[model samples]
Target: MPVVSNPLRALAGALISVLAVSGCQTLDDAGRVIGRADLVNDLAARLDRSTELTYSADYQLPGGRNASISQSQDPLRAAYTYPGGKLTVTADATTACDTSTRKPTCTVTAPQAANAEPSVAIFADMRKRGLVAPPVVVGLLTAAALDPDATIRQYDTTVAGRHATCVEVDQLSDAETAAFDACITGEGALGSFTGTVDGTELEVALSRYRDAVQSGAFDLPAGAGLIDRRADGQPPA
Candidate 1:
């Protein structure tokens, strides 16, 4: 008996199996190398020990120029994973796109990430309050000599509903001051900030923060208590 082999059929079957495997992966898996479940668990663990907070109502620009706007308060989730257990936070955030012409634009805030916290316990606190991420927590013990201390100051105190922890950097030397100012003002820094985590040496950027703000992306309220002011006279929230 001669066994006939169907090459066409065999190739077709192989293609179907590959497609099935591809569909199993989540967005994070395709975009980045981290696993979806692992990133989620890691984020949840860090947020556990953290607190809850909210943003100050974003004010309209001076010229009546509006940015995209929407509002959301759902618990946060891990959207992407970075190396060393770092993760990007995702949630349904609000946006306000049109203000002057009254055209009313609408869009959900996309995923925003924070610096990685030192311990996994912070995730626990994030979960208790329906939040997906934790705030930046700077340690006092890390302060160095002569580095002008900077504070994790906050505004819109009522919106946060609590006091944010203040961590000052060591006195800033003349050179350091220049660098810090540049970094804060979006001149030569890495990128936009989202938020900070306690016990971590990460500095977020304005782009990340704006993404979170525009989307109402924050899940945990604990980090909301912190504020950063702009030199352009925009009030901190």
Candidate 2:
């Protein structure tokens, strides 16, 4: 894993002296701060790094519901699977799978086509549908870093055999109550998170992790109907 630069850490340390240490909330002049700079900065940096890596991770949502994230680069793609459905995105196609029925069907769309089936607003759609995806947690942590009024208490724990730093943030005002808690692994993957987003309460913990993505990480449902809305109307192989 790449450690954040030294100059960034030095600046964060100075801010910590003036600010309180209850929870580490780092504010960059902009967003380029170092890892371990503060609780919030470190976590935010970890999540930001995770976006570029290739891996597959399993998560256990609140009430034992299952979810997962499979991500890879090259063409740049990812799949977020939760309970009964999944959403997969790539440079050319966006696919959403509905598995509640006897036969699962996937609807594919050209990412730039008009009236895309899954909608180009991918992250917003997942949060509205109450999916506990990792990227959403990343957003929360990133926001917390910029909140001056947010106070955090730090803790340490291990999730899926990886050590993670955890924090609980308490916001003084209603405007700042963004996230409740978040944990980040050394490799920058989200270890766990719990909070209300867009009015829905979501809680999830990492259950398993693989450093490398497996074959067929972006594969759609096996033996399912396909609705391809691309210009060519060709199905995925």
Candidate 3:
């Protein structure tokens, strides 16, 4: 959760504290009430709503690296493939595979496991490695929606053969967000994004997107070692 140094966050913290006590709005340098309680709220809304859509998206990342996301609803299962690992979450279990070793392996954890530690650590690690998934991007937009001095402009673009609504967020007063531009397709899929989030510069684009996912999209990688802690109650190894 490392973030860029923004002297203003301290000021924001102070102002927010006062606002908490005084029930007043936080104002920016121009004395304007901060926060985009306006139309920009829809941008964040779109990203959040994307999680409910059943689709598979491939993202082209910087340095020729790539990632993909496949998700389905009703049961709410998702699989994300990053540079060296894959993380899948299902109603029944959380499965993660680390391919950094000579032989990749998957560790499975029950839904009721303590704190869901394995997936939590893996997710935090991925976030630090510049994974700008929809949820993470949503957090950035939410913060901007509250920053009065932040400037947001809207435009249109096409990604992966689909039209998308894009927004550029800049001149933010927050410490963590540097520059953010995201495109959300009509189907609620993230079309593309470029910029920094929490000190991580993430450049990603949707190469292809499909509203339907293939069978076994959530299955663990084939021919890998397995650690089943779903019932053993043992720590992840």
Candidate 4:
């Protein structure tokens, strides 16, 4: 899996701090002290089980730009909607792994410039979609779990009038500094996430979650003027 960038790292760091400050001891269901590794593994497990989820968020980017985000996901597909609906991204996992490198790959289609390179379409689409690649939620969680210096502590909390488990991590070290707090519902869905990256803050909350994805939610809209990198093999028309 590709590593998460500084924004995500910072979000993970803030989550960790929040959980730690909640004053709950690091104890799992088995009554053992939840270490850094254990927490990461636990969160990964929960994320894996969450095959479908939907959420909305407000973000404050590095340049102090405020944006609204709506996202939905299932096991094999993910979609995101930005403010004004001007840019939306949906990526589908066409193959589980590359034949030569055995690395995961996907087919991403999005609106593109007439001069954009075919090879760069997917990456550019990801950047336009707030850098959220396929399986956005799980990808973020997985990246945080892979952090070597991450430490997790969990506590009980209430969010949006619902019971949740607040998991926090501390001392996350990647190529840059970061941390985050995540509130997971009892049903194993992310209720909310709060974090800071390089001093910029981001927060997201789940307004709705379901095991089933809406019809056509993952499909490219009619007349979206999208460019398919794998098919066109040329610049946008």
Scored by lDDT, the top model is: 3
For model 2, residues 1-237, the per-residue Cα lDDT tens digits are 223222122222333343234244455432322222355555555655676678889888867688888878665777888777788876566788887687988988765433222222455555555565554554455455555555667799999999998878677244534557878788877788887776777787899999778787788877878889788776653
lDDT of 1 by residue, 63-140 (tens): 332111112223423221122111222332211122113232222332222222223343333222222122211111
- lDDT digits (tens) for residues 1-237 of candidate 3: 112121112222333333333224445543333324433445545544665578899999888888888887755677888877888866556677877677889888765333221212336546555466665555566566667667877789989899998878898997777978988887767789898766777888999998889887777667768888777554432
TM-scores for all predictions? 0.21, 0.70, 0.74, 0.49
Q: How should the candidates be ordered by TM-score, best one leading? A: 3, 2, 4, 1
Relative to the true structure, candidate 2 reaches a TM of 0.70
Provide C-alpha RMSD values for all models, in order. 21.1, 8.6, 8.4, 12.1
In model 1, the worst 10-residue window by lDDT is 181-190
> Lowest-lDDT window of 10 residues in candidate 3?
1-10
RMSD to the native, candidate 1? Answer: 21.1
**Best-fitting candidate, scored by TM-score:** 3
Query: What ranking of all candidate models by lDDT puts the best one first?
Result: 3, 2, 4, 1
**Candidate 4 error regions (>4 Å):** 1-34, 52-76, 84-151, 197-200, 232-237
Q: lDDT of each prediction vs. the true structure? A: 0.24, 0.64, 0.66, 0.43
